[model samples]
Target: MKKKFPIIETDRLILREVLKEDSADMFLYLSDKEVMKHMGLEPFQTQKETLDEIGWYQTIFKEATGIRWGITHKENGRVIGSCGFFNTHPEHSRAEIGYELSKEYWGKGIASEALEAIIHYGFQHFQLERVEALVEPANSASLKLLEKNGFKQEGLLRHYEFTCGKFDDLYIYSILKGDVVTT
Candidate 1:
């Protein structure tokens, strides 16, 4: 079953549903080449592209296929990034997790806080048995973050994704329901 969209709050951020108004903010980072380097996403060139992406994210929620949260700063209330679970398989009780933060927000612990809340929500609300993440082999920060959250490296997928005009290797990590211990 699809978990309803909920406004997840933490000490410094709020994970909420994306909005059309967020397109401009999304464009800020999504347009940066450095930010899109690891992921296979192209740097968006126009507000139209960001708007279209936002529309797609909304559609994902409406279709009950997946849930993506716009990570917003509580004090400023601007979306700094996004995180969510996709490729959900109700029968298997599993989902793939993905996330990205603006370069300015990197190393701020913002992603960790937001991720913890969402992971907790996934387990408690969706009753998921396992949650997985696919990260670029060189994405050290992400690897560390997943490890901090108890996700174990399962294996490597060679040439698994074509991103930034090249095939990229991905490291698979997973955490089971029984392994979750919310901090």
Candidate 2:
């Protein structure tokens, strides 16, 4: 069964489904090369491009392939980034998690807060037995974030994905249902 999109609120953030109105804010980061460094996506050339990307996200949800939420700052009411699970295999009870934040929101624990909520949702609502993350080798900040959340470093995949005009190595990290401890 497809899990419904639910609004998740943390102390400092709100995680909700992406909307057409979010395209402008999404373009703020999606168009910035520095913010999309590791993601295989090119900077959006225009707001329409961002809207098109949102359409793709809508398809992902409708197809039950994945779900992504716009991470909005509650205090300022600004969308800062996106986080979600994709590559879901219902038969295997597994999914891959991904997230990207605006440059200005980095190092503020916002990602951690949003991810914690989503991970809990994956396990409780979606019945996900395992959640995975694929991160670039050089992204220490992201690596630390996953590790701090109980995701263990699984292995390194050499030349795993082609991005930025070359093949890039990625590190796989995962946390199983048994491994998570609820607070």
Candidate 3:
């Protein structure tokens, strides 16, 4: 059986496993057309879509391969974003991570804090060999955040994702276990 992942906390946010109760909170970000603009994700039109996502999370947790975290504000106790390592390769000991936050909460460093906490958890508990992140080039803030958090830009993949009704290049960024230990 897979071990349960512990919840991670930062000064301003609590990164915990996503629960079905979080659908409404998640909709706050997923519903915003602009939030998904550069992300290649289309705006989720209904609650059922949110429920479907929740169902997927259940499978995700069971596999214990890709640990998912819902980002909630420490002060308000509101779920404002989701950030976690997904597409896990346990044998390879690596994972790809992704995150999305409500526009209302952008620019406050919450994403950065949450990301650091999750990355730390991935390393400490999973013995992750490496963690990778892919961001759309147009989303400068995300790209910048990854860079700020010690992820080095590995390369740009042509038409890496089909998001928001368009095919776009994705900038790959990564930090290895060895790099984390040294830095």
Q: What lDDT does the true structure give each of the candidates?
A: 0.89, 0.90, 0.83
Q: Give per-residue CA lDDT, model 3, range 106-172, as digits (tens).
A: 9999888888888877888888989999888889999889988999998999997776567899889
> How close is each model in CA RMSD to the real structure?
2.1, 1.8, 1.9
Candidate 3, superposed: residue stretches over 4 Å from native = 1-5, 181-183
Residue pairs clashing, model 3:
40-163, 40-164
Residue range 92-163, candidate 1, lDDT tens digits: 999999999999999889989988888999998878899999999888999999999889999999999876
Q: Report the error of model 1 at residue 116, Å.
A: 0.5
Question: Which numbered prediction scores highest in lDDT against the true structure?
Answer: 2
Which lDDT value does model 3 have at 52?
88
**On TM-score, who's better, 2 or 3?**
2
Candidate 2 worst ten-residue window by lDDT: 1-10
Residue 5, candidate 2: C-alpha displacement in angstroms: 2.3
In order of TM-score, best first, we have: 2, 1, 3
Error of 3 at 115 (Å): 0.6
Task: Order the candidates by lDDT, highest first.
Answer: 2, 1, 3
Candidate 2 per-residue C-alpha lDDT over 88-183 given as tens digits, one digit per residue, 9 for 90 to 100:
999999999999999998998989998898999899988999999999988898999999888999899999998868999999999998898654
